[model samples]
Target: DTAVSQTPKYLVTQMGNDKSIKCEQNLGHDTMYWYKQDSKKFLKIMFSYNNKELIINETVPNRFSPKSPDKAHLNLHINSLELGDSAVYFCASSRGQGNTGELFFGEGSRLTVL
Candidate 1:
């Protein structure tokens, strides 16, 4: 089963708390990525990793962290979550960075921090 899967499709919590979401893909692909889609429907690349090496996006905040236990798994941890953090977080995968259109995406983990 070489498909992307993420846990906790929805998460609701108060501001300034800690949360974590998990993602996994059996695609055997070398690269995995995290993307954030805000309320305005803008899809932004967050982080990408290949072979346990982090290829981070400078725009992303340090409060957000990506942990890749292996090639098939990547987990996200958010500390002191803020209200503005509320949005749809997606886990995606590609063979490489030049990865083009329609990346394999998880259903999405919606976090609502109030």
Candidate 2:
């Protein structure tokens, strides 16, 4: 079984439309994160949740929001999607809040906005 999974592996939508990606992990980890990988393959952290608590939030736009209902799930919701929002969103989980542990990443959800 996959340790981490994300729904709608590929998403295509028009600009100004809203979209969301759901993620879940079975590794029983306390920390989960949302990462965005741009076209240039530069990965950046958007949000981090530890034990269902928001821990680290990067400088992402207000249009992007990360919601964690519990320790095992983290969801990303985007409002008024734009062309610039097209990228691969990855869900990851680690053992703790720090960066010292190994992170397990999902297959990634690709979003395309026209």
Candidate 3:
């Protein structure tokens, strides 16, 4: 079984549309995160949740929301998507908050806003 999974690997929509990506992990981790990869392949952390509690918010727009129903799931919701928001969103899970250990990442969800 896949340790981490996200739905709708590819999404194509016009600007101003709303979209969401769901993620789940079975690695029995207590922390989950949402990272965005821009066209230049720069990875940036958008949000981080530990045990369903918000921890890190990296100056992300209010339109971007990270919801974690449980320790195993973290879903990303984008409101009024813009062209600049087009990027690959990756979901990851780690053992504990601020742990330097390896992160288990799910296959990214590519969002294209035209």
Candidate 4:
């Protein structure tokens, strides 16, 4: 079974649209994260939730929101999507609070805006 999975693996739309990506993890982990990969393949953390509590927000735009209903799920919502927002969104999870272990990453959801 897939340890981490995100819906709508591919998204295409015009600018100023609103979109949401859903993620679920079956690994029974306590920490989950949302990461964005730009066109140059640079990965950066956008948000992180530990045990359903927001732990990290990497100065992302207010239009970008992350919701974690529980420890095993984290969802991303973007309002008024811009061309610059087009990138691959990845969902990841870890077993603990610190970076002492491996992070399990999802396949990623590619968002394209024209």
Better-scoring candidate (TM-score), 1 or 3:
3
21-86 per-residue lDDT for model 4 (tens digits): 999999999899999999999999999999999999999999999999889899999999999999
- Provide the global lDDT of candidate 2 against the true structure: 0.94
> TM-scores of the models, in the given order?
0.92, 0.97, 0.97, 0.97
- Candidate 4 positional error at 22, Å: 0.4
> Candidate 3, clashing residue pairs?
none
- Model 1 spans with C-alpha error above 4 angstroms: 97-102
Comparing 1 and 2 by TM-score, which wins?
2
Error of 1 at 65 (Å): 1.0
lDDT of 1 by residue, 1-114 (tens): 639999999999999999999999988777888998999989888988886678876487899989998988999999999999999999998775554545799889999999
lDDT of 3 by residue, 1-114 (tens): 999999889999999999999999999999898999999999999998999999999999999988999999999999999999999999999997776457999999999999
RMSD of each: 1.7, 0.8, 0.8, 0.8
In model 4, pairs of residues that clash are none
Worst 10 residues of 2 by lDDT: 94-103
TM-score of 3: 0.97
lDDT of 2 by residue, 5-67 (tens): 999899999999999999999999999999999999999989999999999889889999899
